[model samples]
Target: MKLSLLLFFTCFLYLQILFSQDVKKQVEVGIIEHLDEFVPSDIQLMNEDGKMVNLKDQIDKPTALIFVYFRCPGICTPLMDGVADVIQKLDMKLAEDYQVITIGFDPREKIDLAIKKKKNYQSLITNQNTDDGWRFFTSDSANIARVTEALGFKYIKAGTDFTHAATVIVLSPNGKITRYLNGTYFLPFEFKLALIEASKGHSGPTMNKILQFCYSYDPVGKAYVLNVTRLSGTLILSLGLIVFLVLIIRKPRKRNYPKN
Candidate 1:
């Protein structure tokens, strides 16, 4: 009976491991990083005012490009809110040093919806006069596809909704991809560094890279939690340091003999 119970427990553990691996694979498939890739400027999109604008014309300064549908039932709102929070905390002047562009990825979404959504986020910003610094756009599927492809963003439709990763793409003044900030919550310092790098027309690593190595995003909780693998690594490192210190302390000091 005990042997049977042990076998059952082992099978359950194996199944849990397989399930975890599957979930990781699903999350990873929805992400693609196009670091240093140049976004095509010729694609056309309708601005909030319903004016036709070329993608290239709007990116005169370092830009933060966000792709989300205004009507998304999940992830989109929190992602935009996170962006607004970061923008408000940033010391940089909008439009002068950098700007933000939010493009609705759902082709069926219209200019009116885009306008309304823009207004919602704009109201969150303290500087109302800097409205020009943040622009919202809606366009046909063809144009949307071009931009998403260029940025290496991939999304899959699930019923009437979409499954996608929360990301912010930082673009250089010339529209080259500089960095990607993953997850809804962003660190202001890392964002500021991204802007500085983008302004220089170069891609640089985000400050969160090392932190991300130690944590994994918890989609259900909408936060990053400690990753077991990295936590184990950290524990091993600590143990090694402790062992080294013990060995050094135990080593006998050189005997002081009566030297002539």
Candidate 2:
């Protein structure tokens, strides 16, 4: 009877966990990272000049791909601002060593708004050539879905606004996703590192990292924060060694008996 009860409880707990995961999957509204995956060559978007341009064709250099609607009233502005600030800060020349492509995910958005938005941000930059380096686009729902899914950018349309996360997806010259720089703010060191990796077509995964994971750059604090988990683990190992050494040193030594 006890064995049967135990099995029943185990089955019930498993079902509850599965249900929770399924619900979470349904409302998952942020990036579902597809590391090292190549962006689809066929996905196309309309450029600021109202020309249909293939995404792959536009990515001839290390690219920072940003997705936003021109009319978005939330995180989009800060996101674009973050990109602009980083561009101004970094020594790397824009559109030469790397390029930025901002795609409008709202199907209803058109070229005119895209062009206006591009000009707005371009004006914010000082002495930087915005004509070629940073470009913007508008895309239909079909192409947007294709590209977003390819890059694992998930969003849900709520009323007139959309729910999404602020992030920059760094891609190599050949359109391979190399790294995801999260949040509206960014650090120059990590940003440069990500671009360097993207330039070489390397994916910085979470578990099996290709670039870095231990020493992450903190934008607010303006410092590189070491991983606490890794640090604690190291301390535990060192503590064990110290304890063993103390035991060995304190241990009583055998005394020599002279012809007792």
Candidate 3:
């Protein structure tokens, strides 16, 4: 009887772990298409300078919008670094052609923290004039919810931290969602195409479809891991072939093209 009880208890624990994994998979899959949706213009946030401003005012040109909290211990730093690297590699001017905006999703995060984060990333950029082009913002929970919901940016708070997907939203000049780029590492050519599409007020294809099958964040590891789920293997190979064909057909453009 003692041995049987111990075996039952072990089985119960395994089942519980499997259930939790299923729940997490559902949550990750919840983040999906918000293409062509216009962001909430009335939502107000405090900029790095601690000045109250409407969210729409800062998006007069193509903007790469990122939602992250300063205290995030997981994917936030990598996400910001990826964007900074893309900005440095791009041939286009920052403020003149496009802009980058980061908003802290945690209401507890203060403008001082935003300013400090801004300074850290700004130092990485080689273009001095791009200083004003990149901005950081913090806002109250009410305003933050309004914008996050509009963009379909789902995040769940766990104690003092939040678990959210690592992705970037490309917005048009007038604050319309144009494209979604999944994961931290972005190719410069794909990023340039996104910016060009956004500048012309055109929405691009969702990049998350292929990414979902290829990677999933491991909360315990605090990093992305290979997604070896049942159906992912076949989908991964199919997407790989499609990407290869697309790349072969697309010719590389000279980096000297005039900025919009």
Candidate 4:
């Protein structure tokens, strides 16, 4: 009876190990294909000039994307304002290397409204020709849906409010998501760092990136962060070590038990 029980438990443990191995394999596969899966699609979006433009064709260089509704009274307005403040503080030469794209989530908004918003932001920038670097646009529902889907942006319209991730996504010149800044407001320093990292130090300030690397997330500060995948992996590894230690400590006791 004892041997039968042991065999049953052994088989259960073996199955558990196999299942875990399968899960780990799946996770590795996911990580391996993450970049390929996330490459932005060549969805057509309308330009400020009311021309139908393909997103991939519009990229003269790397770009940052902000998702918002033009009429958003709560988060979107201040979010854009805060981002504009950061852009204002950046040196013009460094800022010229990248473009800022504001995509309105509201389908009713026309290209004229988008052009107005672009002009508003342009007025805020201290440097001339910031318009060449910064841009804004609104697209029809279909194109907006396509671009947001590509970027993994989920939103629900709640009467007068938009319930969505208040985030900014940084994309490579080839339109791959490099880093995402969560929350409506972001620190200029962290934005600068992410830009530098993306540009490989040929664009944004290197010294600022180094100085700001060690700072952790502050919810009130609305700072950018490393993604949750890193945190979850650390947690899983810690739990694995604890389980291994517990098994090692229990093995000797089980071996020493009297044969009954």
- Highest lDDT scorer: 3
Question: How high is the CA lDDT of each candidate model?
Answer: 0.79, 0.79, 0.81, 0.62
lDDT tens digits, residue span 1-260, model 3: 46545755565576556545554564543356689989887999998667899999889999999999999998999999999999998888888888988999999999999898888877788774456788889999999989988887887876778778888899999999999998788898999899999999999777464455456666777676776773464555556655655665584765886889
User: Which candidate order results from sorting by lDDT in descending order?
Assistant: 3, 2, 1, 4
Model 2: which residue pairs collide? none
The digit string of per-residue lDDT tens for model 1 on 1-260 reads 46545755665576556545544554442445678889896799999779889998888898998999988867889999999998888888887888999999899999999889888877789863447888899999999888888887777776776666678999998888989887788888988999999999888655343443456655556445678875685566557656755765587778889989
* Alpha carbon deviation, residue 108, candidate 2 (Å): 0.6
Clash pairs (backbone) in predicted model 4? none
lDDT score, candidate 2, position 123: 86
lDDT of 2: 0.79
Report the number of clashing residue pairs per model: 0, 0, 0, 0
**Clash-forming residue pairs, model 1:** none
Off by over 4 Å in 4: 1-39, 92-95, 200-260
Candidate 4 per-residue C-alpha lDDT over 1-260 given as tens digits, one digit per residue, 9 for 90 to 100:
46545755675586556545543433311111122233455677777777877777666555677888887665677778877887877653433677787888788888788788877877777664565676777777887777777666666566665555456777667666667665556687888776665554222212222212222333334333454554465457557656755665566543566789
TM-score against native, each model: 0.71, 0.72, 0.76, 0.62
Off by over 4 Å in 2: 1-27, 206-260
Per-residue lDDT of candidate 2, residues 1-260 (tens digit): 46545755665576556544543553345566788899998998898778898999999899998999888877789899999999899888898988888999999999899999988888889757788999998889999999999998877786787767667999999999998887779888888989999999888964312112333333344333566764565466557656755765687888989995
